[model samples]
Target: MSLAVALALGTALALPAVAFADADDSDNLMRKKRFGQNTGTVTTNSNTGGHSQESGSKATTETAVISDGAITPFITADGAAAMQAVADKYAAVVAQGGWPKVPSGKLKKGSTGKGPAALNKRLFMEGYLRAEATEGEYAQVFTSATEDALRRFQRNHGLSVTGVIDGPTLGALNVPADRRLATIKANIPRLAEYSKDIGNRYIVVNIPAQQIEAVNDGKVYSLHNAIVGRPSRPTPVVMTPLTVIRFNPYWNAPASIVEKDIVPRMTSSGASKVMRDMNMKIFNGVGGPEIDPDSVNWRRAVVDNYHFRQEPGGSNAMATAKIEFNSPFGIYLHDTPEPHLFHTGSRFYSSGCVRVDKVAILIDWILQGQDGINSSRIAELAETKERLDKPVTNSPQLRVAYLTSWPTRDGVAAFRSDVYQLDGTGFVVGQPLPVGETQGGKRYVLKPIPRSLEAVDADEAVGFASIFRRSSDRIDASERLPGASSKSTDSLVSLKDPKAKLKAQGRDTGKKKSKAASNGKTRAWTGNRERSASEVMSMPDADGTTAKKPGSKKVASKKAKSGDKSKTAKAKADEKAKTTKSTKVVKKDKTEVAAKKPDAKAVTDKKKALTDATKTASADSKSATQKSNTAKAAKPADCKAGADGKLPAGCKPAAAAKKPPAKPEKTAATPAKTASSTN
Candidate 1:
């Protein structure tokens, strides 16, 4: 048999098994019945000639199952073929060295340059431009044909079809062909995996591309720009069924927002202002009493005690509607108050919920066959601005996926920015993605992950308290304050001791004095007695003790003693000369003089008198030394001793030696008698 015939027979054989398998599960059968699956299943009966016969027939269908929970077969055979065709085309391009990169610059209609030439060549390679269009030199010009081709390429890639080659266009054009091929190869498994058991109608959200598409019978019914969560608060990947559509929905701000955004603003701007501005009402707790904003301490209530709910209005965070689905992450799709955010190429601004453009259209699409929910009814409800909850009889499956690269209808692989860095490819954190990409088109930079704003603000408010806390509180309990000299109980003991009080006061005074005295020059007293004596002598005594001038008397006595000695020596020399001149007469005179000279006893007594005078002088000097020793011993004990054991300044030394040794009176007669006896 032919290949086509064999495939047809295989499909025919597979249909009954799928129908039976679905029938085997009562839940699946009920779901299918609710979704109006296999509506062609019919039974017929006819009776003729008293005989009865029955005939039954059923219709078969194919579906795609992208994930475990997804029941819809959104990808049909044609869709799979189209995707595979694009992949195959890119694989061939990879083999042919891929499309050449356009020069890095902006190129639009009426601009002619090498950039336009390269762009045209690339578009031609990718099948946007026809072969015959690349013939002439004017082909390089940004002509209408080139503009049309560019627009077609942009439309296929989910970019703004401006026909202008902006930065994002250039970035897309510059991606290496090998990388494009790798993306196609990487996604082939996903395409195949999703090619089975999908529902008849479902929603597909491309997280990386920030776009959402509603598919029915393998064809796109609605397309919308999606504002997913920021990188720090990424939209979670999920596959589940959405069963309810809420009109003019009340938005209960998530705990994250209450703690991070609301509480801090409340603390800074006050509860009343924030509450009024946000159009929010505070509740005692979840489903509890309605509390006035002024009734509670916002700083404490925001942390764990209160819940915030914004009344339904145009200014509400959830603009006008919300689509609820079953997922562990509590994520859902809704409309946004800031509709302008949808105009940008990259829409990633929500905390974690997805904000869809023209969400009313999406809602209409989701509630097509459900009772009391149609395009006109939805429009009327939205105009009324009243809260309404509409239940969907047959819910549609939703699949949120991270697909940075995918095949476009024009047989080219379109690449988007890895906004969440989910692909494991290295990229700058905050750098905007290329134009025509998902995240960085209009200067949207990545921000840090949000923490509890109330926690941060509270900490700042208590910063001063933390600063002034005692050492034990700030550091450890065992650690005392620096230089805490006494225990708490010591205050009473210190009061009872006068000496202790004085010592404490002295310590305090000494500290102050040391600080004050450091600024002046200090003179330390050394123990040099000579310098001390000089200083003492220089000053006039108040008592008349130093008035007599002791040094003058000592000098005079010394002069008189030297004068007497000199006279005696001169007289002896004269007597000797006279004895030499007249020998006999001199001899008779010498004998008479010698006889007149004192006897030995008298000479010995004179010697004894001289020894006594010498002994008396020595005794006077010793007595003066004893007096100095006694004075030194009597010095105050508090006086600091110097290096030589002398007292410090403010103490006096012993009085000067009482008197110089008394000088013996001059003895002229005795010297003459001695000279005559020697002659």
Candidate 2:
């Protein structure tokens, strides 16, 4: 028989046993159905349902047994294939099971549907599974065992302990198996690029999944659902370490956020008052360099002017608590007033910072005080509200970071959305992946297993000599250290103290010097010594040699005697030089004087002639003015108007002498007229 025929024969033999209840349990023989009754003996040929065992007779339907809560065929052969197909779609969820248990309600008997299984797994991956224990003996069943496993899965994946599977779980389970696998594999390429090494303690945020995983010592320490930035303002991808946790942090409004979200909202009528209610501090970003909110035209300005900030207040997006880090991305973890947002499966909703679910729990871990900030004391202080107002002990250190890709337990690459979508997309900064490749159009995908962080010198050098030079300068300037001198050893410590402050400040200071030193001028004090001292000295003389004045010269007798220009004549010259050189060569000998006298006298005579001509012109002008005045005095009295109303037209009464002519009005004199008078 053909292969198809052999399979049909096997089904035929299996069919009869199902109809005969006496073949198995005693309870099965006395079958009384709630909806129907079973009677007598029943027989049927099963070799072929399409044709009868006896020729010329119609084929009869085979009967199935129902007993002991077991159907004759628990599952059809084809149905088993269908179940595997469902499993394939939720491969990511199943893979997560290696670390997490199955969520509650996910494996309940009535809940076992193809769609639900996939969704349950998806919910598990997102850290949103809520599991509850199944009720009754039903919990003892294998199905119940699976449900319990699902609950463990939910807890492991960072979900709440709700036994029943929900829509989130169902969505996770329903992910197509190929797509799920693809997502994992796609991230593999970016594994090495994600972090130098994830370090002993680091955070991993999966954007697609919207969850935060805290891994330490190659194991998951804690997990939490995170509310990431909105699509328009997605979280960025970067590598940073946690260093501080600022409790009751004040929000310094970033300019872009103020422009996009704060300004317009404020300008809309009652915004200022609302912002005041929200404890926001407004600043001006446009009018001047410093952002002064009061200087802004609040009457005409909108809330979106890019200068508003929600100060340290309960309603602020930055929250009362802050996780301080030094990442260029400037992200931090914090608490939110709106804790209910965590309940929903989707938590991606923030400006750029990460909003943590169960933040208090996470704080309990970071603040354990073993290595990082002691968070417990900070929480206590937060309650009292007095610690932040003054100095308080046990402050938590926070370090916010941005990581787009990371590894799974099995070393598979994982990627998250570039929630803050910074312009740069790449492996580090420049090596971006081809478009439509990874989640960020960047190259953070699964690759070879990542290596550990590179070896960096934890022992920082104090650069004592360099530091001493700097301090000595300040000392010379009479400026003391910013603090009062104390006998305490800590008073002498500075940024060089590595125990408390981050390594970033020192590293940055080092880098800044590198570029500045390259030009060679910043450290070229020795190169300009002579030029700098030049101002303190006297001027040079002819022939380009510096001249010594009489005050600087010492009295000395001339051994050579007067310059001998042939004995006697030279004697007088040499004698005179000796005396005059003492006064910067003021003395002149008779021979030298006779030689230059005629030329000097001629120059003097020319100057005297020029002076005499100037004096003669001055005298002539004065005499002319006096003569004119005398003439005016002789003629003015008789030239007045006649009593008969007739006057000499020629004399014109001297125009009453015109009071020496009033000064011309400024308007009457144009620039051209002034130029003519000057000419």
Best by lDDT: 1
lDDT values, one for every candidate: 0.55, 0.39
- What TM-score would every model get versus the actual structure? 0.50, 0.38
> How do the residues 1-679 of candidate 1 rate in per-residue lDDT, one tens digit apiece?
4222322232322211001110011111112111111112112111100010011021011111122222212234344466678777777877998888798777889988787888888988878888766668776788899998886666444455568987656766777877766665655544444433457788877676676767776655655657677764566555556767888877776665565456656655567777777677877767789876655544334344566777776366665788776544556787766655555655566666677777776777677747867767776776677788876777877776556655554456555566665453322122223222232112222332223544445333333333444545422211122322222222322656776675545554324344333312222121111122223343333232332323545545655655665565566667667655753334545634543444577667666665666566667767877997987798776676678999777776546776554333323334445444434
Provide C-alpha RMSD values for all models, in order. 33.4, 32.8
> Over the full model, what C-alpha lDDT does candidate 1 score relative to the true structure?
0.55
Which run of 10 residues does model 2 get worst, by summed lDDT?
A: 17-26
